[model samples]
Target chain A: MKFTNFLQISILLLTLTFLNYFIVYQKCPAVTYDDKTVIHQLSKQNVNEKIFFITPTYSRPVQEAELTRLSHTLLLVSNLRWIIVEDSDQKTLLITQFLQRISKMKIFENFEYTHLNVETPKSFKTSRRDPNWLKPRGVWQRNEALRWLRENTTEKGIVYFGDDDNTYDLRLFEEMRNTKKVSVFPVGLVGGLMVEKPLIENGKVIGFNSIWKPKRKFPIDMSGFAINSQLIHDKHDAYFSPYVPRGYQETHLLTQLIHSINELEPKADSCTKILVWHTRTEMPKLKKI
Target chain B: MKFTNFLQISILLLTLTFLNYFIVYQKCPAVTYDDKTVIHQLSKQNVNEKIFFITPTYSRPVQEAELTRLSHTLLLVSNLRWIIVEDSDQKTLLITQFLQRISKMKIFENFEYTHLNVETPKSFKTSRRDPNWLKPRGVWQRNEALRWLRENTTEKGIVYFGDDDNTYDLRLFEEMRNTKKVSVFPVGLVGGLMVEKPLIENGKVIGFNSIWKPKRKFPIDMSGFAINSQLIHDKHDAYFSPYVPRGYQETHLLTQLIHSINELEPKADSCTKILVWHTRTEMPKLKKI
Candidate 1:
């Protein structure tokens, strides 16, 4: 009777183990790849410096729609990795599933990405009714991406803050690719100006042409600049600040990373042509169910 | 001895049954709904007539992006059902999963949709090199939707052929909802015309303002017309022709459905406003992997 009991217990344990394995297998099937397939395609780029597009995003009604439009534009470029940091306590299954589906597409087969989530403190978070410009958002999320880059990346690359809602022209990526230290460009439809541009004199960025507040050292939007990876790595303590004033986020962060104003390299034909736009989609009126 | 054998077999059967049930339950969990939940929201609309938007789409690099944009616009309207027919041999998992996600959103909680796939014949399918106008597309897919509507839908409704690539203003849906018979409107940037419009005289469509072959009965694009569901059911065999001439698609189908121009109801403020655009997204330039 003792032998039979032991035998039944052993059989039950074996069955449970096999069942667990089968369930896991069904949930995540094996991904078959050819011999030439590079799992992380960003590490295999032949360029002198890769471009890391860091976008800090949050959950909203238009989150997936905005990402879909942006992904279509980004998929055209080469040697680029998208670092998407979400504003959530934990990584949501919706976003993870979306990123996985996009990554599997043939057009994005060579694309590389990293998904990170860092929740914003309740005090710093703004209400939905607040105007976007009045509230300083994406501060901690951007810092988290910068922190990840500093800890994981050692190779040469460029870091750019690409807001999900902004419209990007393909030529802007090419300009950032050749960035040596810090590149600046013209951003259209921003700061109540036709173009908030980097004022270039003698092929160097002297000042900014922003109409809102030209008093700051670097009066540019988030999409207006790109920093070299080496510079970011060298300046270990530089990151975006949440305590800064409404419009001082850009200036406050740039001052820490750059030793002098001369480090700013004007791009997009000496900041004469607008290659990017601060265009925002109008909120769709959804009827109450 | 026989009684013991029977007991052993019963135990084995029970164990197998429990394991199978556990595996199936793990694969697909249940979805809970409250009393206020709207399962088939399309059937709950108070409107006398529903609008069925039939869109024939194929898998492309920008398929999801285009569909997402279209969904944003369509979600704003009430009493509408989107019939997305895929031009493939079988329904793809990608399209099915995409529809499921979109339908679950709060903004689209009331949106209803049907997914169907009908493969284009090998001989008629055009290559990528061919210009869009040269190839007659969406012929069979539209027919499949019409057939489904005839067989499945018995209530009063309006059927409109909406292309996935076009841009629709919200006002267009309101105009289509009040369609009496075959509603005619102006489609902007179509057939190399600034606006292919219906020339109204005394609240009736007299002719077309189209520069591209105005001799035809209805010189408008696919997005410019909406037909009553009852008329389609009465015709019994009316559908788009795959063998029509390069520019005769709209005319060939309209002639079969409408006996005279008097039956057309001019909409969108007497067909003056260009509420929809025949806009297309340019193909992204991606490097070969």
Candidate 2:
């Protein structure tokens, strides 16, 4: 090729490459539509890896509100399969309506989801007087999602345990999307500390910044780590057990999922910044109107 | 100019214009940065219009969680200036910490925010048995935000009243960004109805879908509308009044701001879809350890 012609073609190629990058990361802005029914959302059409977001929820005064807020945030993320396991024998109307309404929007037209219900046994439930942390909650609900994942698909994806009320930064999903083993990040306002994270040494998970249960093997919150779907398939016996002691659920799950703590991949700039928060919504006190 | 040269230049101009549209309507993906510091958000740099989002927040068990979630959503939008007014004698440490920490993040590098406070008088505050509708709420706090906006800027912008807890669709901001006058959209789950919105005729707001107090001038939820900042300048006395009867605060403000109901502009696909929701957080029941 002539030198001048090569230079001109090179410039065009570079422009195309940069613009392609711009489209994928900026979130493809939803296409404009006259009818709100066919609205679109900024999407990740160029990316291939998917996320399986598992959430356990129960009926509460703010259940609809919490789910609605959470659904909006989740919609911002692309390539996500929302697997909501309700803490009830059957899926409630509130959640069904939420999903159905959200699915009707054209912006979320391609959004994938699964709604399931498996009630937590009464014996495992926390009493009004007892502190909520006294028992390991969502054991059965999460297990049901796990059973679904194993039985339903052999797809390669990332599995994250998300809370209905917790705050999530969109960047958190981007960091977790590439998890090779178990990707770990910081959880803010957790365990009375501003942040709890896996201490990274040369990008290896050496220890944790947790003050509570410092002696536990994993020493992480449930929101702290995301596993490759391969881990779930590899460890059929891995499950969240209610029989474990308080604050041991994370350690128990991590023990079964990994060969060693070193297998953890540190994300969100090696846990220097918190991408998730362990936030709990207050139960509202109400009167029958 | 030669016809052949003019044709080549015209083709190039067309390509540039098309590329600009793609970059804009397609959200410009944030640039990559290795440091957790100096992170960037998908921004609307090409658009000139700005949204001044005024939010009223108070101390509650879920206050931090609510702010964190709302902040994340706001960070996704470009050209937005957040004005937060606290319902307290002075801004609480919790809110201070929330803003300061968020400001430190690079992903929110270009985010603009203002925080102020004004206490709700004892008479205006609702008691536990008052059913929350007995007295007007957020009147003083929202007024404080308005005063701040008027004092701080002479820029042409759209002003919106937002709550710390309500669910917001990201598209809601885009719909309101170009308001020439009052722009209204549907609010979901409000006033014991599934959706409440401005009834549109031709292109103007003719009436409303409200079941409660349909005769009111602007029978809409507080989360339903946006105004051009010029309207705030035009209506000096237009403010959310505490003296209004139950559910009349919206009507009271609209009465001052508009000369005729014909000035109202219908948005969010002419009020066909719910872009905002009146979702309240459940107060948490916590036991002292």
Candidate 3:
């Protein structure tokens, strides 16, 4: 009887150990890439710094071309990961296939839409109309890119949301890489008033001169600023909200970030000259495609 | 031969006359409704005195409730038409059906969401998250609503973009109806920015006091003022733009219609105490709806 009891105890212990091993394995997240391979490549020689360029494209081809040109220029400074979020469900072959061929770029395509209904009358069709400012439409896709950076990136680098239609100077990314909280630059063709920017004092941002009414906070544009990955990782709520009034998109997101606008570092000669212009692409009349 | 030619000419003239009559019958635009037939029973005897309440709604149940309450209260006012524009694609059945049940108010529902997507990143999906201050989503929607008024409204009275979330006193409408070019008032919720109104001296509007920054125009909420229909009809571009940074939605739209700050008429005892608070609704989380 003693020998039988000893055998049963041994069996029980073995089963428990097997269960613990299984649980630990389940908790471990799978790595999508070979880390040692990436590490070896990094040690061998220096490639350009990696920049995740997120561009939102709707129905404009010219804007896409302009963005592609911007991407080529960015290639000079860093590895360009152009994640193009198209406003369609099924990826169009034109944009999707074109992006896939580009070296060192990850192309993601998807679509999203939201509408107001509780106050609309029966006779009007309100939900089907495309939103004006493209409120947080591609935000989740941006978060996806952030997730990719967190998981894939070993080297420190910069991330930016480049609107498909805007003009960019090559120097902007170098300026962005130096961001502490968020670096703001002047944007033209916005605010209906004039180019908007932050009033800098002693190499620190005092406040913004935005002509449009944003809620009390860092009232700036999504494109006009850049943030460090460390800041984004540290801050819990760094994403934009759709529910913010039409113009408060940028301000509301930045408000929850680091306290003190003084923490925001100003670049591009204290944001005097325009580094970015908030230009919009007119709807193209597509013919034969 | 001469008789045959004359007969052909006569036949051609007869055909041309009949074609003219048919074209006129088909091409003349249809008047959607004769006011006398549908809501003539609800019309007040007060002919010269009329009030028009215009409101823009995005997506908030509480704001909608406020609008519904306002619609119910407007039952007291004579000859009131509530123009509600939904900033969505298709009209929501819920909102449409609700408007259908309301009496003593002609609910004209329209939708446009053009200004919501300038620099928005493709993958951001920020529109899904709820934020405070549901300001005008589309500059063109207001323009479209005003254009509709120019084409449709034959009534004489006041016009205001009573945003769905604002708190309003019925007495405020009385002060607004007498406005010549524009009227100003104090708005709450803006921290220390206090009230924005035409600075008056000797019964003249000189300039405005907006404590906000960046926007070239005075900082004001959408619910801060009212305008005479004539001014809207007379102005060239009387609408908001996404191009305007955070706080300039009100200022830009107002500046287009009025020349100097002197043109703005002050109400609520020259904006002494806030009559209307720029209150916003809090998002309610439900475990199960």
Candidate 4:
């Protein structure tokens, strides 16, 4: 080759070598469902991780729609089953119809509105002065859903009790898939109680930022948690209790399953970006019955 | 006088002097209310101060008996008006009749079930594929109660939103009687987030031990606070908003009222002792239902 041609070829080889090393060194950024392409790319990655989207649904249809949209959107990306328990008066035709749309999803539509009119029991003459009667109902409904899952699901999967009113991000499941035991993440629209997770150090969960009640067994809310199937299968009862205090629903269940926060997986990927937010839709002023 | 008689008199004088100095130097230990006599004795000491027993009731009649008993018991000690707001669906006739028996006590029965269910527009279909018809409902019920009190009540008294499930010691009200602004004390059964209150120094309110969302406008629970009516009257819209995030209920309202934690009065007298706790009663298991 001529001297000019040799110089050009040598420069091209150096550029090619630099590009190869750059590809090897740089890792891919954490996946966020910023758009459909990201989700499609995630789906094509080929991980057969089974995710059990254990959600607790009440009468709110708007929330149910949100969950269904989330599930259907997620089902396209991976092997998933939505173990949705309806905490309703009865399994309504409406909820049944909604669940039919989500493919590869199992609908557990059964609940009783046992704690109707909490005020009636607190009435001086009617209640005979019993203070325990004022507790909100439906804690057992969550337990019932949990029990049903343990008995029915033979496959290994992640379990999460997503309340009906909450706003969820689809990417949350992908992050939780690798959780060995129970994993915790930040929830947005939860006022300023942002980023509740185990204080992890060198891959070990140390403590929690549950400043409101740090002494409680489980300081996080139902939505802020994701437990491994093994944890659920290990426990005999594997259920929540009606006897637990109002906010103790999450705490009581966590105590039975995990030894310490060290057992919990902490995901702060979306911690800066609010993933799941505890947003309750407002009760509209009805124009007269 | 005889030498024996003079010695006895000298000993008696010394004993009286020691007792007088003890009473002046070390204030009497808070008279325990293990029984009714202690309550009666305290009632006589503070007879001139008008007692306002504000009980925030809910639908559970059985749970509210403790609150009703406290209200009734307070009536015996001094003039107390039970500002009982029922967190119910309708005006309960039984609660109305029960309040009638208490003399000089005003029972305000109001119903606002904001937490249990969110109200959506009828046209808001269950599924979003159809159309966007969902509208959030009754987000201002608690704010209405606060506005009603501000607009109506001219009397300067202590205001407390005592939830139905809570256990209250009658002496707690007396402790809060002289509160100029807002006073906070520890509550039992609320140790999950142990000892939430204003940080005080030299009998002045400073800040809070709020580990959660302390930065939120109001970061306190309903049961953990008691404010003078003037604060409510001054901060016109300082009531709660249902539309806000779940835990922001306390913080949101507090931010709108006070400029700083400096305005809050800390009652550390019972800080070591849990007084008004955020205890939610458990759901009872009914085999038949």
Best by lDDT: 2
Q: Looking at model 3, how many pairs of residues clash? A: 58
Measured against the true structure, the TM-scores of the candidates, in listed sequence, are 0.48, 0.63, 0.38, 0.39
Per-residue lDDT value at B118 in model 4:
22
* lDDT digits (tens) for residues B1-289 of candidate 2: 4555545655675576567656654443322222211112123333367788999888765576677788767765666788889888987887887786555432333467888999999977988777766877889989988888788788888999998888787668878877888888998777667677888889887887677788887888889989999989877677888888888988888888887779888898878977677776555434332
Better of 3 and 4 by lDDT: 3
Please list the Cα RMSD from the true structure of every candidate, rounded to 1 decimal place: 16.1, 9.5, 30.2, 30.4
* Order of quality (lDDT): 2, 1, 3, 4
Over A197-279, each residue of candidate 3 has an lDDT whose tens digit, in order, gives: 88888887888876567435777777888766666666645675545666676676677676778778788888886656564
| Candidate 3 segments exceeding 4 Å error | A1-289, B1-49, B61-64, B104-126, B130-138, B191-198, B207-209
Please give the CA lDDT of all the candidate structures. Answer: 0.74, 0.75, 0.54, 0.52
How accurate locally is residue A116 in candidate 1, as Cα lDDT from 0 to 100? 96
- True-vs-predicted CA distance for residue A180, candidate 1, Å: 26
Query: Highest TM-score: which candidate?
Result: 2
Model 3 docking category: incorrect
Judged by lDDT relative to the true structure, which candidate is superior, 1 or 2?
2
- What digit string (tens of lDDT, one per residue) describes model 2 on residues A1-289? 3555545654675576567656654443322222111012124333356889999998865566677677767765667789999999888887997786555432232457899999989988888789878887889999999999999979889999998988887678888888988989998777767677888888788998777778999988999999999989999889898899999988888899887898989999988977787776655433233
Which scores better on TM-score, 1 or 3?
1
| Ten residues in sequence with the least summed lDDT for candidate 2 chain B | B33-42
For residue A61, give model 4's deviation from the true position in Å: 7.1
Error of 3 at A188 (Å): 45
Badly placed stretches (over 4 Å) of model 2 are A1-46, A104-110, A127-130, B1-52, B56-68, B71-141, B148-159, B169-233, B240-289
